[model samples]
Target: MEDSDDFLRLILDSIAENIAVIDEGGGIRFVNHSWSQFGSDNACSITQDWSKMNYLSVCDSAALAGDEFGMLAGNGIKSVIDQKEAYFNLEYPCHSNNEQRWFIMRVSPFELNKERFFVISHQDVTERKLAEKAVEKLARRDGLTNIYNRRAFDEILSEQWQQCLTLKQPISLAVIDLDHFKLLNDTYGHQIGDDCLIAVSALLKNFARRTGDVCARYGGEEFAVIWSYTTLLEALVLSKALLEEIRQLKIPNERSPIAPYMTASIGLVEMTPNRILETRDLIAQADDLLYQAKESGRNKVSSLIVVPSSAVENQN
Candidate 1:
């Protein structure tokens, strides 16, 4: 029995996991090389008691709960250990070199002579996680302006629409068109016009960073943003901010009639859950407002706020 036990221990310890044997009294009796390595470099030995380690609480909780506690030990880790089942592919973010790093953890429980034991393994998966995230971002991002792509916009819109339907929240949509973008291209060359587009995109992006905001390039010289759960007044504020931000760019629009430099026309439309508003209708209304801004004079913002009346009222 002793030979068999020693052989088994040798084999299990050889595997890449922090393996430790706990006696019936719940004290750590043995810790393999892998287990010792999990401790801080300043620590002298693994049998020095688990409570002395900085991460003891994290490890203990994960051992008790099947839930996914984070690397710092929360409900997640506890879920796995409490169930006495195997856990795999658990991911959590860590800070290394002042940057985010990801780790994949696996934990399993074992027993010997009625004593409880556990094996834990953690692998650095930062590179793989970053690659996967980058791919997802590229798939959902517009190449030109680095805004969310139309595909992402569609997904967000559909999700928000469903949410608004259920929660009866308000959703606002805006369509913005660059004023005389073709004229700018003709006067400054297409390359310079592209630069202007990039600059304008940056300004719009800054505003869209707010909660429940999403922005996308709807195609050439045109961009769109959807604000979920936003009031009409809030939507109007963003619209005004967007127009002013573009004007501040000072792209030297010597050819523009509305201003000495480049400018944009923005149209905003808000829909409430009480109203039956389709995404297409919301877009069309905002587009109509954009045209209104152009008609009145470019470089201005016009909002079409939906109300109890059948007719639309204009807000600047």
Candidate 2:
């Protein structure tokens, strides 16, 4: 029996993935050779003497400490241990400060010596995760400007609208159009027009670097941006500074009447969504503002504030 136990331990260690056995009480009963080594390699603090650790407590504690990944893992494992589920599997990011890494955690229950125990395994899945992320990014980004495509922009904005509405947070939206884009394209040809769009996209990307800010290529010669949790007063200040920065870029547009260099007209809208309002309301208002800007002067800003009916006059 002793020799057989030694052979079983050897066989378990021979497998590459990190493996551990937890008793019904949720205490670590055994760990294969790769377990501690993998923990050490990944900078996990729990590597030393893992057998003495209470695995479930560690996970629960981490979850309580605000680790989202740990919370998912704790719930999944608890479900299996309680016999509510036969198996559990989770893929999660475990990236350190230096290198990106992903791993899959698999937990299963088994009978050992007339008692139930769990076998947990951790397998590196960084390559597959990274590949999926790359594909997702390509599908979301525009081919021409390298910013978000119209489809992604629509989906993202709709989601943000719902989120802000639920949270009762302020949201700002802006639509920007290159002044005299058609004439500029006709004069300089499509190549130069594309170049101008790319340059403008870069500047918009730079301007929307705030947390929860999104910038996207809305359509040909048109762009849009959104700032979550921002009021009209704040957005107006940012827009003024942004337009000044863009004007300073000095990208030549000979056919543009707004300036000898490229210039843009902006339409801005700010709202704190309520049950009575719809996401399209913001878009329509911003589009109106953009039209008014162009009508008043080619390179100016027009804005509208959307608030509750009672507060409408105050906003105006």
Candidate 3:
């Protein structure tokens, strides 16, 4: 019987997942080698001996300290222990200072000698999670410029619009078009035009360093930027700076008119979102302003603030 128990322990230790068993009262009953190793590697407080610890108490402490995953894991384990749930599973991030990591925790209940126990296992799922993120990024990124694509731009704009609406903050959008880009492509091969787009996209990325800022390839030689919590005046300042930076790139545009170097025209709009207005209205207004910039001689910013009808009526 002792040899048989030793063999079972060896098999459990050989498994890669961190496994542990707890009694009905959540008292740690046993833990496999992987569980001990993981605790030691992570410098966990429970590395010395888990038998003296209560698993549910650890989760409760984490919950009190504002760990949502802890609260969820505690509830899941309790449901399984109470026989209300046959099994429980959760996926969560547990990133370390050195690298990002993900793990899936699974809990299953069992009975031995008429005593109920719960077996919990945590499996690393970082590789699969990273692969999923890679695929999602490719779907949202432009192949040529390596910037967010038009679809991503639309999604980001709509999301930011909703957030700004909920916060009652201002959101800004910029519609930028390269001046005479078709002529530039026609004059100096498509390769040069592609290179120019790459350079401009790289520059635009610098301005979008903020949490809610997004720069995307709108389509062709056009690009869009979404600035959360920004007013029209603030957007105009940045738009003018962007224009100068693009001109500073000095990508030769010896095709026809407008400076000897490449230049761009921008249409900028800022608005405090309201139920009466849609995201499309913001785009439309910015597109119109962009047209105005082009018509008024390219390489400048035309900006406006869109006031909802209710706000205008309230002002009167």
Q: Estimate TM-scores for all models.
A: 0.65, 0.84, 0.90
lDDT tens digits by residue: candidate 3, 185-255: 98899999999999999999988989899999999999999999998778888888999999999999887
Q: Which 10 successive residues of model 3 have the least lDDT summed?
A: 307-316
lDDT computed for candidate 1 = 0.74
Ranking 1 against 2 by TM-score, winner = 2
Predictions ranked by TM-score, top down? Answer: 3, 2, 1
Off by over 4 Å in 1: 1-123, 157-168, 254-260, 274-281, 295-297, 307-311
Query: What's the CA error at residue 151 for candidate 3, in Å?
Result: 2.7
Number of the top-ranking candidate, with lDDT as the measure: 3
TM-score of 2: 0.84
The per-residue C-alpha lDDT of model 3 at residue 126 equals 99
Which candidate has the highest TM-score of all? 3
Per-residue lDDT tens digits for candidate 1, residues 1-316, read 6579688777766866555543323344566656666564425464456644434454565556753444334343445446634653466775555677777666556776775554556666778999999999999988888998788887888788778868988898988899888888988898998898888888878878876788898889999988998977888888888888888888877877777788888888888745466777777888898888889987777886776566566746
Q: Rank the candidates by lDDT, best first.
A: 3, 2, 1
Model 2: pairs clashing at backbone N, Cα or C within 3 Å: none
